[model samples]
Target: MSSDNWTEQDVPDQRGRVAIVTGANTGLGFETARTLAARGAKVVLAVRDAGKGKQAAARIAGDVTVQTLDLTSLDSVRSAAAELREAHPRIDLLINNAGVMYTPKRTTADGFELQFGTNHLGHFALTGLLLDRLLPVPGSRVVTVSSTGHRIRAAIHFDDLQWERAYSRTGAYGQSKLANLMFTYALQRRLARHSTTVATAAHPGVSNTELIRNTPAPLRLPVTWLAPLLTQKPEMGALPTLRAATDPAANGGDYYGPGGMGELRGTPKRVASSPASHDEAVQERLWTVSEELTGVTFPVE
Candidate 1:
C-alpha cells in the first residue's frame, strides 16, 4: 500500500490481539480504540474517569473493557499497570494516546509540569511497567502519539523541566510532544536486541478534538473559526495512530502522520519529524531524566 493512500480500511486483522489505549473516553483516543475493537482486538480503555471509560466502552462493539488510569498521578499509573498486567499477561499493542495540551500553569501530583508529567512521564512509566509482557510477544508494539507541535517552539527544558522559572503553554506542550518522539527513538534502540517488540510514533495532524479546549484565546478564536475548513475530524485524526499500530509495513522508529500539505490532514503516511527530535544526545538525556523522574525502568538494556 502506498503511504499517500493508507486508510483505516487498510488495517489488518487483529483477532486475539489485546490493545490498551489511554484516554480512550473521547476524541482521537476513542476513535482509535473503536477502530481496533471493531477489527477483533480486545480493547482496554485506560482512562482517568471510570464512568467516562464505561460510557466510551458501551458505545463500542466487540470485547471492550475499561480500566481506571490517572496519568497525572504516578500512583494511579502504577495501579493501572498492575491491573493490566494481571488481566492481559501479554499486550499486543500499548498506545500511549492520552495527553494534555496548552493549559494554565499547573503541576502533576508529583510537582512536575502538567503537560510533561502527564503526556510524557505518565506514558513513560506505564510503558516501562508493561514492557516485560510485550517483550515475549512477537510483533507486539508500543505506539506513542506525538504532535507537529513538537516542531513549533519546542525544546526539552533540561534545566527547568518543571517550568518553575517561566511558563508558556504552547512551549510546554511542544516539549511534552517532543519527549514522546524522543522516547520512541530511544526505546526502539533498546528494543532492537529483543527484536520481538517494536516502538513507533504518530501524530494526528491538526484534528478537531477536545484537546483544543485549552488553546489560548487569541489563537483559539481563529482555530475555532477555521477548524471546520482546516482541521480533520477525530476519526480522520486517528488514522495515523491506527496505521502506526496495525500497519503491516510499519517498522520500529517509523512515524505516521497526515500526508497532506503541512501535514494538516490527509491519508496516513510515513512522515518526518523536526530535526531537533532526532538529536541522539538529547533523546538519551531525556530518557535518563525520565527514568529518574518516573522511577520506572524497563527490563530491556
Candidate 2:
C-alpha cells in the first residue's frame, strides 16, 4: 500500500506470529490471508461457510486454518472465538474484513438489520471477546476494513441506528462504513490507553470481488467492465490493509486506501476521515451502543 511496488516478498519474516482474517475465503480477504500465510504467519480463516472456507484455505499458498464464523449471530461469533482460543493462545493480527454491502433489507437471525449487524456489530463482538488474547501478544494489530462510502452518511442516529424508520440500502451501507471508521478511531484511542494493540482501517476501492455479485445486473456491468480502469484488483485492494498490518512505520488509527481519482483505486495512501467521523462524542455514543448490543465490553471490562 505504501507504493505500487509493495509486494508480499517485502514483508518481514513472521514465522511466530498468528493472524486471523475474517471472511478470508475470497476477494481482498483472500489476498490478505494468502499474503500473510505466504509471509510465514500462522493464518486462520474465519468464514461463515465451511466448504468455501476450506477451499479458500487450500488456495492460499501458506499454512492456514479455516473456521466457521457467522458475524451476524452472537452465538456463532462467540462459538468461533471460543473454538479459536481453545487452540491458539497468541494472536498477532485480527482483520475485521468480512462485510456485506448494500443488501436489500433483510433481518439477521438476531432480528437486527443485516448489513449493520454483519459488517459492524459482528466484528465489534469478535474483537472485544478476543481482546484478552490480543492484548497479551506483543506488537499485535487489528485492521478494520472501512470504505470511502463513510464520506456519505457519517451520522449515527442513536434512536434508530438500524435504519428501521427510513431504509435506503446505500445509506445503510454508508452509515455502516462510517461506523467502521469511527470504531477504528475509538478503538485505537482505547487501545492506546490500555493495550499495545494498534487498530487501523483500509478500503478496497471498488475491487472486483464477489462482494458485488448481489447488486443488480446494470449496476454490476459498469463495475465489471470498468473496474480495471476505476477499481484496483482485489490483490491491489488488500495491500492497504496488509501494509497497515506489516509496515514498520504504519501508525495506529491511520486509515489507508487507494490513491487514485477521488480515492477510488490505486496504491495505498494514508487518508483522513470525514470531519463527522472525528466527533469524539459520537464515537463514544456509538461504542456504548455497540457494547450494549453485542454484549461485549472493552477496556473497562
Residues 169-218 of candidate 1: C-alpha lDDT, one tens digit per residue:
99999999999999999999999987679999999999999999999989
In order of listing, the candidates' clash counts read: 0, 0
lDDT of 2 by residue, 1-301 (tens): 3255566566777788999999999999999998889889999999999899999888888789988999989999999989988878888999999999878888777877888899889999999888778897778999999888888755676777788898877778888898898999999998888887889998877787887876646677876777667766788889888887888777889888877778777777777779998899999999989999888897533
Q: Note the Cα lDDT for every prediction shown.
A: 0.95, 0.85
Q: Which residues of candidate 1, in runs, are more than 4 Å off?
A: none
The residue pairs found clashing in candidate 1 are none
Backbone-clash count (model 2): 0
Off by over 4 Å in 2: 1-5, 216-218
TM-score of 1: 0.99
Candidate 1 weakest ten by summed lDDT:
1-10
In angstroms, give how far residue 299 of model 2 lies from its true place: 3.9
